[model samples]
Target: MKIKDFPHAGETPPFGAGGSGVGLYIHIPFCKQACHYCDFHFSTSLKKKNELVDALCQEMILRKDEIPGPLQTIYFGGGTPSLLEAEELAQIFKTIDSHFEVNPDAEITLEANPDDLTEAKLKMLAASRINRLSIGVQSFFEEDLKLMNRAHNAIEAVTCLELAKNYFDNISIDLIYGMPDMSDARWQENLDKTLALDIPHISSYALTVEPNTALQKFIEKGVVKPVDDAVAQGHFEILIERMQQAGFENYEFSNFGKPGYYSQNNTAYWTGKSYLGIGPSAHSYDGETRSWNVNSNPKYIKAIQSGELPIERETLSVTDKYNEYVMTGLRTIWGISLIKIEESFGLKFKEYALQQAQKHIEEHLLFLDQDRIVVTQKGKFLSDGLASDLFLINLS
Candidate 1:
């Protein structure tokens, strides 16, 4: 059955209107092959696909009471959400419809790889309730794809976008920069191609070698060159320049979008809205507490089948909340609100935040716009570090 047959399928809700509505994140932790630099929890084998899907649905039903409000956004993130068959997707959608109050114009998104977006699959997805597609293109060059061991080749990358654009209007593609031997010129060409395709939203990130990953071993063995922070910084500058000229706002550190195409699901997260995360290795956040399910497929399935939740929870302290706000706020175009710090936190917290920000302001890496502490263009690349400097280690 198609998702349009469901009651909540209709025109999209007004952009930025559902800031208070809840979000749902369904994690499909299965992949055909593992990327070299990846560290997310997932299995290369689909031996438990059917069981996992059932467990996902069960988890939704088990935790339905956690979310009392209508869902404004539902995201299918993964190891590869596109790997699910049409029937499997339909089953999950049916469960969501039965248990949750989904807004008629909810922003439903599914993340897909370029190779998975064959014409038939695109047609199937377009007919479903998924109104947005986040394609994992990574790069438009063969060498880069091979280095990262992405499932799709450069040809499939471009071809999928060509076909997907026909069926999906709200599309976002991922692009990686700062790889070894990725020259500034080559990075520019990648951006040029993305703009040429007229994709609405783009999420780009620098390549980092995570500990215990294949990338780290490769670098240790000298099979791959180490990642250079200076090189990454230069490429980021180029990215900021190119996307701005294309009229795409760098709304968040790694995300860029046109006027009306920002990701509502992610925006909700940055603004501290609560979301329910389902499936193995998924995390859920309420306004004050954070929780995550067990990160093992077999274990997660076993627990759910037994009517138990294999989960862990943590409650945020006032210091924890203030620190999180500073971290997420600085990474976005919204910056940190001094008034929010005082109101949500306390007067002491606001005084400490301003005190910490003075150094960045004097160095011209940050500035005060009215009452907001905003990062300057020169400071954008170092936003994370800047935010850390502003973090309160102990508020006792």
Candidate 2:
């Protein structure tokens, strides 16, 4: 079949035609060690790295027909995509180039760790097609680094950013806030250091202890103090104020970016654009259905090598789509469109949404802007809960 003649042709508007375009997410499931708060799919052992890389390339070939046209964004996310050798990245990129037509201005990003980004490595990446870098510099303090067990030290975080700035222009760094012992002053210092570095984009989040993770176990055993939501909320408020003062847009709940520096890959996802995800535990969506590959590395490699895809699929219900739209839209700067809800899902759903949102609006947590419902600055942190209250449980 011709690449442009895919099954869902014309189902959605093409990005080049002024709408959001398709994206590709390649998951690399290898890390030197696991972080205490992380629950994402990954393994510490690099024994199967070669086999996994081969599987990733093969999976791309198998799913190349799934994309409608040229890719607008390509993201290498994971346990540490920076761990891949230059040659490995080349081989993968060669396969992508051969099978797909990438846009000349495509936003190709690679998620890296601070320790892996040496001067040599930065130079190597600058020479490649990766135009953006998302470095995992979770914290800038030595105690926080030790508590989280991050591979890089505080100095490495600063040094890598200094070196990386000389090579790449579009750079983003991750920061975590609201740890047990984190004071308001400490959080402010973190923001201060980020601004001093002149980073273009920042993705920060409150530290949450996930079930079965080391953090959870520690909290349970009293070895580590339990996380306090009040502290997290305070940190979040500080973050918003600081970033605003620094001329950064709180584009999404957890992301802040300078003008023209927003993450295209992430924006597409929040706006409900389709994307093709490759590699083990990666997810793929094509407007209607959502599918994910097997999370087990050995199983994934074996399946791909045998010319089979180890995936599971689910077709979203109308209510499911509406709920998702409300959830994502509320968290973003682009407010939920009452017109879109009614036009796409029917007048009943739109009316239901407004009726549900009325209470919050009266409380000064929400407001109507012409034909859309937007969260107030006071409501931004509670977007998820507010969105849930507007969900239609019986519409499906």
Each candidate: what lDDT?
A: 0.90, 0.89
Candidate 2 structure quality by residue, lDDT tens digits, 1-396: 222312222132123224345899999999999999999999999999999999999999999999987899999999899999999999999999999989888999999999999999999999999999999998899999988989999999999999999999999999999998999999999999999999999999999998899999999999899999999999999999999899897777898989778888877887788899999999999878899999999999999999999999999888888998999878777668888888888888998999999999899777676677777778888999999999988774
For candidate 2, give the lDDT of residue 244: 88
Task: TM-score each candidate.
Answer: 0.95, 0.95
Which regions of candidate 1 fall more than 4 Å away from where they truly are? 1-19
Error of 2 at 257 (Å): 0.4
Q: Model 2 shows how many backbone clashes?
A: 0
Candidate 1 structure quality by residue, lDDT tens digits, 223-317: 99889999999999999999989988787889998988889987887767889999999999998899999999999999999999999999999
For candidate 2, the TM-score is 0.95
Using lDDT as the measure, which candidate wins?
A: 1
Clashing pairs in 2: none
What is the clash count for each candidate, in the order shown?
Answer: 0, 0
Worst 10 residues of 1 by lDDT: 5-14
201 Cα displacement, candidate 2 (Å): 0.2
In model 2, state the lDDT of residue 79.
86
